[model samples]
Target chain A: MTQTALAETRTAEQGMAAHARAWLDANLPDALREDRPSTRRNTVAELCDWEAKLHRAGLVGATWPKEYGGGGLGLRAHLDISREIGRTPMPESVNSIGKELAGPIIMAVGRPEQKAEYLPAILEMRDIWCQGFSEPNAGSDLAGLRTRAVQTADGWVVNGQKIWTSGASKSRRCLLLARTGPVEDRHRGLVLFALRTDTPGVDIREIQSIDGERSFCEVFLNNVVIPEEDMLGSPDEGWAAATRVLSIERATNRMHRAWRFENQLNHLVSACLSDPATRHLAESTYRRALAEVSVNIELLKGHVETLVGSLIDGQEIGPRGSLPKLFWSEAHQGFARLALEIVSQFPVEASDTLRVARKRMEDIYLKSRAETIYAGTTEIQLDIISKRILQLKRKA
Target chain B: MTTDTELNPEDFVETARAVTTACAEAAGLPERMDLLAEAGLTGILAPEAVGGMDLPLGFAVPVLRAAGGGFLAAPLLECMLLARAFAGVDDALASAIVSGEMPVTVAWSGMLGGTSGVVGRAPLAEACARVLVLGADEGGVLVTPGEGAMVETESTLDLERPEARVRVTAASGPELSADAVARLRADALVLRAALILGAAEDCLSRAADYAQERVQFGRPLSANQSIQHHLARDCLAVETIRNNIHRSLSPECAVPAAAARATFVGAATLGARVAESAIQVHGGMGFTWEVPLHRHLRMIKALAAQGGAADLIEAVAADLLANAA
Candidate 1:
C-alpha cells in the first residue's frame, strides 16, 4: 500500500510491456492480419521463409545455445518473444517442432555434430518436421507404440505405421518414437529417431479431419533407413528427452497456439458489424471470453516465466507440464467452440468471406477435438496433478 | 500483466488464513455474520485512516478463502464488497463501513440495459438504507426506510445469503454519480472475487476430506486413483482460478474489469465440478439435505447464472483469439 511499492509495481509493469512492444514491432509482420481466421492461411513454405527472415533479422532462437543458430538470450526474453508473437497474427510459424520438440531434445542430448546440422535448419524453418509418436493403439498410453525400428549396419531400418502425424506430408523428417523391445518394455524400449519422411520406404496419406485442413496424416514406414547420428539423445532415452518439449524454451508451439486463438477472437468480434443487439451481444461475449483467455495466456506466461526463472537459476519444472498443456488446450477448445457458435449466429453479409470463416470455425472446432485427446487427455493431466503436485500414492 | 508465480505467494495465503481464523473464532460458524463486524472485515477496502484495514483486493482474497473453510454464507461478506467500493482513500463511506453501521447490496442481473427499464429497483434501496446498481448508468444509492422494500426468495443452496426482488418507492437520500458507481462496482467485484475464491477453496477441502474418509466396498474413496486424481485436479482448478483473481487485483495485472467476470466464471465452473464430485464421493449421503455438498454446488450455480459469468466467459474467450491477431 505504500507509494513506493505501488510505484515499483507500475514501473515493472511498464518495463515488461516495453519489452513486449519491442519484440512485436520488430517481429510481428503486418502482412498476416487477414480479416478472417483461417486454420490454413499460412503454408509450410511461407512460414519457413518468414522464419529464415526472422533468423536473418536476429529475432529467432532466443534460448537456443550460442553454438546453435540461436539468439542465446535467456528464457525470459524467449518467453517475451512468445508473448510478443501473440500480439500479431503473422502466418503460423512452420518449424514449431523444430523450436519446441526437436530442437530442445537435440540440444539436451544430441552429439555436437547432430546439433550443428539439425538446430540451424529448425531456426531457418528449412526442414519441416512431424512427430511420429502415437500409433493406432497408443495415445494416452503412448509408451505402448507399435512402430518398429530394427537395427541394421547402416543404422536402423524402421517399419511401422504412425497415425495422427501432423504435417507429415510436408515434413522432411520426423522425431519418431518406435518400439525396439518387447511390449512389456513399454516405457524403456522406445527410441526416438529423426527419420527422413521422403525415404522410399515411407508413405504419407492425409487424414482429413473435421477441420478441412489435411494437417493430420497416416504415415507408413516400411524398411525406412535412418542414419545413426540423427537420433536425439541416447538409445532408450526418448521419454526423458521428450520432457524438454514441455519446458518454456522448447514449448513455443503451445505459446503459438495460445497466440493464434487470441487473434481469431478479435476478428470475430469486430467482423460482426450488423444488428446492434446481436453485434453488441457478440462483442460482449467475445470480450468476456477474451478476458478469460487473457488470464489463461497470462497464466501460461506465468508458468513460462517460472520455468524460465527457475532454469536461469538451474531449477527444473519436471511434470508440471500437464497443468499448462491441459489448461491451454481445454481453454483453446472452449474458445474454438465459442467462435463457431458466435459466427453461426451472424447472417451472411459477404457469402464468400463469412461463409468460409463460418465453415472454417466449424471445421477447426471439430478438428481441435483431437488436441485434448492427443498429446494427453485431460484425465492424464489429473493423474499428474495427483501423483506429482499432491504427492498422492498410486491407488490401492 | 501480473503473472501467477509473482502474485500467488505463500505469505499472502498465510494472511488470508490468519484473518479468516480470527474472524471465524470471533464470530460463529456455518453463518458468521458477527465476524464481519468483529474483524472490521465488513470494511476491508475502507481507508486505514477510518479504522478499516487498508488491504488491496488481491490481499483480501485469502481472507475470503479462509471464511469459506467453514460452510457459512451470509450477506455480511457481500456488504463488505459494497463497502470496499464506496470507501475510497478518504470517503466517509469508509468510516461507516469500519463501524459496521451502514449496509447495502448491488444488483447487476441486468447488465445489458435490460435491468434499467425492465427490472425493478433494489430493495436495499429502502429496506437496508442503501443500494448499489451497475450499468452504463451505474451508481450507489443511499436509501431511507421509506425508499424501498423487497419480495424475498430464499435460495435452496446458500440459504445464508438471501436474495430478493426489490421495489424502490422513494429516493430519500443522495444518488451516487455514474463515475462513483463505476469505481465502486470495480472495487466490489474485486471483493466478490475474493469471496468466491474462499468458497472454492472450501469446496476443494470438502472434496479432499470426503475422498479420504468416505468408504465404499471396504475401501476409502481416495483409494481410487481416478477419483483421487479428480479431487486433486479440482485443487489445481481452484488454485489457478485463485491465482487469476489475485492477478486481476494486482497493480501490475490491473486488468480488473476483465478479471471480475473471468474469475467468476472460472470459479463457478470449477466449484460446480468439485461440488458435484464431492457429492458423488459421498454416494447417497451427499444427496441428502443434511449434507453440505449440494448447498455449495447450488450456491455456485445460483451466483454463476445471476451475474455475467457465462456471458463474460464466452466474450472473453473470443477476445483471447481475437487480440492474438
Candidate 2:
C-alpha cells in the first residue's frame, strides 16, 4: 500500500475511535448509565435536555447543511456519531420524526424558507415532530388515505383523522400528508404539510397500546388551517416526497433499532447474571433459543453496518431496505418474547438492573409485536420487495 | 511452478462464469472437469509462486457461486478449497494442483483414527486423485491418496457430484495442525455458502422467468401476489446471505467462525427454501428430471448437511453468550 493512503486510513480510524471515546464519556448521564435498559420513559423535557447536550457536543445534525444549524460534516460523520451513540442504552431521540424524517425531506426538497425556518428548531430540539402518514384505513395502503386538504383564499383547510401517530400529544409539529386532489387520485394529489400540533383544530387523543405506553395517539384534524407556504414540496407531488421520506426513514430508523436490540440483548444477559434462577433457566430450556436470538442480533449488526456504509456512500438501498427491516423486526420480537419468559423466572429483586430489565423486557416484548405492523407491515414490505425489487407481475 | 502473478476478482469471476457455462452442457463429468481445468480454475486459489493465480480466498466465493449457478460437475470448488489447505503445507502437492497433475477432494466431515472404522464418504472422493480426511475429533487432519483407500462409488440425489465411502487403511500423509483443520472447516463452510447463494440466485431467477412466461388463468403466474411474495421472501434470504458474506470478508473479521454462522443460516437453511420455491413456480414441469431445477433442490439437501448447520448455530450462539457473560 502507498504511504499516503495508509496514513489516511490510520487517521480516519483514529479520529473515529477518539470521537467514540469522547462521546461515551460525556453524553451519558448517571441516570442513563445506571439504567441498563434505559427505562426513563424519555419524557420530552428529558429528551430535549439530552438533545441539547448532543448539540453542544456538535453531534446532532452532523450531516445536515452547516448554515441551518447542522455540523455540515459528511454522511460518514453522521454514521460515526450514530454508532457511538448506540454504545449506550439511551432513549431514542425525541425529535426522531423531525430529525430523521422531516429534516431530511426539507433538506432534500424543501424551499429555502422551509429549511431555514424548521431545520434549526429540529436540530435544537425546540420543535418535536410526529408523522401523520397512516390514517385508520390507510395503514399499509398509505396512498388510499382519505384525508382532505381543500385550498381556500387564505390557506388550506385540512380535516381528517390520523391513527397510530406516536408522540402526537408531545410533539409541536406534524409532518402531515393530506389529499389535495380528488380522492381517487391515489398518491398523486397528496400534499405534505408541516402542520403545527397546537393549531386551533388539532386534537390529540392518547391511546394506551399493549405495551402499556400511551406513546401512540390518534390525531383529529378539524379544519386545521395550514398556510400554503407550509407545504413541504410541490402540491400534488406529496407521493414523491413521501417516498423519499419513507426511504430515509427506513434507512436510518432501522439501523438504530438493530443497535438498540443489541443493547437489549446485552441487558438480558446481564439480568441472567444477576439472578441464579434466570441463569439456570437460560442454561436449561432457553439456551438455544436465547443463543439463536444472539446470533440474529449479531447478524443484524453486520447487516446494518453494511447498510450504513451504503447510505454514506449515497448508494441506493431501494427495496433492499426491506431485508434488514424484516430480519430485525422478527429477530427482535423473538428475542424480546424469549427474554420475557426467561426473566419472569428470576426472583423479584430491588436491584436496579433487575428492576429495569423486567420493565424493559415487558415493554420490548409488547412493542415488538407492533414492530412488524408499523413502518410498513411485513406483508407490505414483502409486496414491495417482490413486486418492485424482484420485478414480479401484478395479478390480473 | 515458480510464478508471481496477481489476480483480479472481477476477471476471475468473468472467466469462471464463461468456462462454467460452457461446461454446464458438457456430455459427461470428465469433459466438464477437463474444460474447467483447462480454464485454470482448478488451481486458481494456490499461490502464484506455485503456478497458480494465488488469488485471495475471497475470489473463490463468487467463482463458486457461478459454478453453482451453472451446476458444473467438475469439482472445481473442492479443488480450490483443497488447494487452500495444501498451500505452503506441501509445495509439491500445491504445484500438482495448479498444473492439474493431481486433482484433490475432501470429505464433508471425517476423523483421524483409522482403527475407528469407516468415515462416511467425503464429497467427490471417487473422482479425485487424493482425498483429504479431515480430523474432527483428533487435532490433526490427514491426507490419504485416493488409490490406497477402500472406495465404493454410490448413487446420490445430486447427480452432478459423485461421492464414496472410503476406509483409509493407509492413514499416513501430511498432517495439518488443529488450527489448520479448523480453518479448513471454516473455509469449506464459506465456500459452501457461496454455492448455496449462487444456486438460490439461479433458482429465484429461473422461477421469476417461468412466472413471467407461464400463464395461469390467462395471466402470468407472477401476476399472482402469492407467487410474487414467495419469490420476494426468497430474494430477502438471498440478499441477506450476500450481506453476511460481504461482512465475513471484511478485514476487521479476524476469524471465519462468524462467517460460518452466516453460511449456516444463508446456505444450509435458505438454500432449500429457494430451490423448493423454484420448483413450486414450475409446478408439474419442476417435478420431472428434465427441467434441471431439481438438481438445485438435491444439491441444497446434500450441502445443508455437509457442515452441520446445527453445530454452526451452536458455535455462534456460544460465542455470543460467552461475550455477554
How does each model score on lDDT?
0.62, 0.75
> Fraction of native Cα contacts kept in each candidate?
0.31, 0.61
lDDT of 1 by residue, B258-299 (tens): 656556666667667777777776778888999776666766
- The candidates' DockQ values read 0.25, 0.54
TM-score of 1: 0.75
State the TM-score of candidate 2 restricted to chain B: 0.89
lDDT of 1 by residue, A66-177 (tens): 6788765555555455665665656556667667787878777778888898888888777878888888888768877888877889998888888989888888978888
Q: Candidate 2 at residue A311, lDDT?
A: 77
Q: Tell me the TM-score of chain B in each candidate.
A: 0.77, 0.89
Cα lDDT for residue A263, candidate 1:
59
Candidate 2, residues B58-155, lDDT tens digits: the string is 77888888988888776677777666667888878877776666766666655746433456546676767777675545544445545446656666
TM-score, each model? Answer: 0.75, 0.90
